[model samples]
Target: SRSKNSNKERNLIRAFTVLDAYASKLSMPENAKEHAAYIYRKAVSKDIIRGSSIPSMMAASVFAACKQLGIPRSMNDTAKVANMSKKKLSRTYKRLVKNLELNVSSFEADYVSKISNSLSVSEKTARLAGKIIHDLKKEHLHVGKNPIGITAASLYLSAINYDEHVSIEKISKKTNISTVTIRKMIKLLRPFASKYLKSIDLSV
Candidate 1:
C-alpha cells in the first residue's frame, strides 16, 4: 500500500510539472491553471489518465480548461507549447472531453482580443474585429467554424477598413492558423464586410 501510494504521488507531481510548463508557456491565467489542475485531478480519480502520457494528458487538460473558461488559446498554440503534434493533442483533448463530460464551447469573439493583441492592432481595429465577430454570431455564421480562423479573418478585415496594413501572412503567423483557412474565412466574411463597415462608420 505504501509503495502504491508513493507511485500515485509521483505520477501526480510529474503530471503537474508538465501542466505548469505548458501553462506558463501559454501564459495561462492563475484561475485557468487552477481549473486545469482540478480537471487533471478529476481525470486521475476517474482513471482516465491511465495509459495516456503525462504531457498529452496535461496538454489536453489545459486546453479543455481554456475552452471551458473561454480563453482564446488555440489547439495549435497549446500543441506547440506542449511539444506535441496537433493531431495527438486534439485526439487527447477529445478523449478528455468525452471522459470528463466537459461542456467545452468557445467563440470567435472570445479570440478577438488575443489575436488583436498579438498582432498589435489599434484599439479601434480590435473593437471593429469584435463587432464583426458579434454581428456574424447573431446570424449563427460562426457556428461549426474554426474560432481562430474566423477571429483572424475578422481582424484582417478590420485592419483593411482602418487602413492598418496588417497582412494575412502576419495574422497566420501570429495565430498559427493557415493562410488558406484565414482566406476561406475572409471569403465568408466579405459579403458581410460592407454591412459591418457601414455599422462601424455610422457609430463613429
Candidate 2:
C-alpha cells in the first residue's frame, strides 16, 4: 500500500497548498484556516474529493468552514481570492456540503467592513453603514433578504450622505451583486433611513 499512501500524501500536500494560498489571499484568521484544513481531511475521508479539482475542493472546504464559523467571507470574495469562477466554486461548495453533511450555521454577516475596505469608504462611513444594518436587524427587515445586497445598499446610502463618492457600479463589482438588486434594496431601506438616519434627506 506504499503507492496508495504516497498518493494520499501528495493529495494532502496539494490541498494544503491551495488552502494556504487562498487563506493568505483572503486573510483568513488562524482559527478559520485550521478549521478549513480539518474539513479538508474530513472530505478526504468521505472520498468526495476524488472527482473534483483539488483547488476547488480545498476552496470549497474553506468556504464551508467559514460558514460554520460565521466568518464574514462570502462566496464571491472566496471565489475571487481562489482565482476560480463563482459558479464553479458554488457548485463545488454545494457538493461538499451535501456529501460531507457539513453543518454550516447561518449567521448575520458584517459586510460593511468587507465592502468598505474593498471600496475604500471612510471608517466613519462604515460605522454609519453598520448602524444601518443594526437598525434593519432590530426592525426584522433583514430576514429572508440578501445580506450582502442590503449591506451594499446601506453603505451606498451612508457614503452619499457622508459625501464619500462610492458608486453603485463599484459596489456591484466588489459584491458580485447586480445594480438593480442594490437599487431595490435601497428603496426598501429608504423609509428606515428617513426615520433613523434623519440627517440625510431621502426625498430625491
Candidate 3:
C-alpha cells in the first residue's frame, strides 16, 4: 500500500503543477490548487484512474475542480495545459463527473479580477470590465457562455477604452481562450458596451 500512496502523492503533485501552469494567476490560486488535489484523491479512491490516461485524469479533475470551486479556468484552458483537445477535455471531464459524482455547481465565474491580475491592468480597468460583465449578466446575455471568453472580451474593451492598448491575441494567450470566441463576445456586447463605458467615462 506504500507504493500506492506514493503514486497518489506523485500524481497529486503532478496535477497541481499542471494546473498551476494555466491557473497561476487565479484570484484564489491556492483554493483551486488544493481542490484539484482533492478531486484527484477522490477519483483515485473510486479507482476511476484505472486503465485511463494519467494526464487526462488530472486534467479532467482540474477542470471539474475549477467548476466545482466556481473558478475561471475553462475546459479549453485545461486542455491547453494538458496538451489535449477541447473535445477530449470535455469527454474526460464528463467522465470524471460521472464516475466521481462530483457536486458540480452552477457556473458563477469570478473572472474579472483574475483576468485583471493576469493582464496587470489597473484596478479601475478591472472594475470597468467587471461592470461590463455585470451588465451582461443583468441583461441575461452572459448565460450559457464561457466566462474566460467573456472576461477576455470585457478586459479588451476596458483596455482600449482606457488606453491600455492590450490586444486580442495577448488576452487569448493569457486566458487560454480562443481569439474567435473573444471577438464574438466583443461584437455581442458592442450595442450595450457604450452604456457601461459611458458610465465609467470611457468610449467604445
In lDDT terms, which candidate is top?
1
TM-scores of the models, in the given order?
0.59, 0.57, 0.56
For model 1, how does the per-residue alpha-carbon lDDT over 1-204 read when each residue is reduced to its tens digit? 999778778989998898888878998888899999999999888889888898999899999997876566888899999898999999988989999999885655557776888899999998888887887788998887888888899888898888887888998878767789889998887766777564433121
lDDT of each: 0.84, 0.83, 0.75
Off by over 4 Å in 2: 107-204
**Candidate 2: deviation at residue 69, Å?**
0.7
- Model 1: residue 125 alpha-carbon error in angstroms: 19
For residues 122-186, write the lDDT of model 3, one tens digit per residue: 88888888777788889899877887788788888878777888888898877767788888988
Best by TM-score: 1
The 10-residue segment with the lowest total lDDT in model 1: 195-204
Q: Tens digit of lDDT per residue, candidate 2, span 13-124?
A: 9899888899998888888999999999988888898898889899999999877755657789899988899999999999999998887756334466777888998998
| Residue 142 in candidate 3, Cα distance off native in Å | 1.2
Candidate that beats the other on lDDT, 1 or 3, i.e. the better one: 1
Q: What is the C-alpha RMSD of each candidate to the true structure, in Å?
A: 7.4, 8.1, 7.3
Give the Cα error of residue 186 in candidate 2, in Å: 16
